[model samples]
Target: MPHTLAYIPTPAPATPFAVGETVEVLDREHVVLSVQTIKKVTRKKVKTDCGREWMLDGEWFDGESSYPFPSIRRKA
Candidate 1:
């Protein structure tokens, strides 16, 4: 029996929503504006060149209030 290697995938930039990195969320591309950490919880503020914002958690979980959170594509 062959053992399969365990691979831990990581998002680009090693840090989510890194400043100046282009990312795609919900099929749209935007650049990271800034990242904020409050009480150890991280949040990323991303916006488009035109000032359009696609609000999302740092983890890319866009679930509704108290709803099930699912992982989405971290980058383009």
Candidate 2:
């Protein structure tokens, strides 16, 4: 009898929002200005009514009240 090798699959990374996309952040809506990827890290530059800000994917998982991830949506 021959034994078969088991193949393991890895999950794909999540995609970041694109520029000109509308995102709801901090109870307000904003537009994604840019998406930067450095060293496998993805950061989004967003423009809101208050001002422009940078957001990272890790912020959503972290338990930091001050830094929260915003709800991203596509512009219709």
Candidate 3:
């Protein structure tokens, strides 16, 4: 006899950002330039007047994935 394991599907995590929202980036304040949907995936574009910019995805901030980019937080 062979043993089998059950498979389950999980819901995608929610994003903590919104378009045109200001968030703290790299200890500084930045604005979310845009939120684009590409092939069913979400992408957030952030930038500062000093020319600091980045395009972030779920894996960058989600707990289940590796986070290698600067931390982002809601403006106080």
Best candidate (score: lDDT): 3
Q: Estimate the TM-score for candidate 3.
A: 0.30
Native-to-model Cα distance after best TM-score fit, residue 62 in candidate 1, in Å: 14
User: Which residue pairs clash within candidate 2?
Assistant: none
Assess each prediction's global lDDT (C-alpha) against the native. 0.35, 0.35, 0.38
* TM-score (C-alpha) between model 1 and the true structure: 0.28
Per-residue lDDT for 1-76 in model 3, tens only? 9955432222222554455555544311223433332222134544433344434532234433434344344444
Candidate 3's C-alpha runs over 4 A off are 1-15, 27-69
Top candidate on TM-score is 2
lDDT of 1 by residue, 1-76 (tens): 9966442222334454544554433312233333322222225434443344433442333333311111123444
Error of 1 at 44 (Å): 5.9
Off by over 4 Å in 2: 1-13, 27-44, 58-66, 69-76
Count of steric clashes across candidates, in order: 0, 0, 0
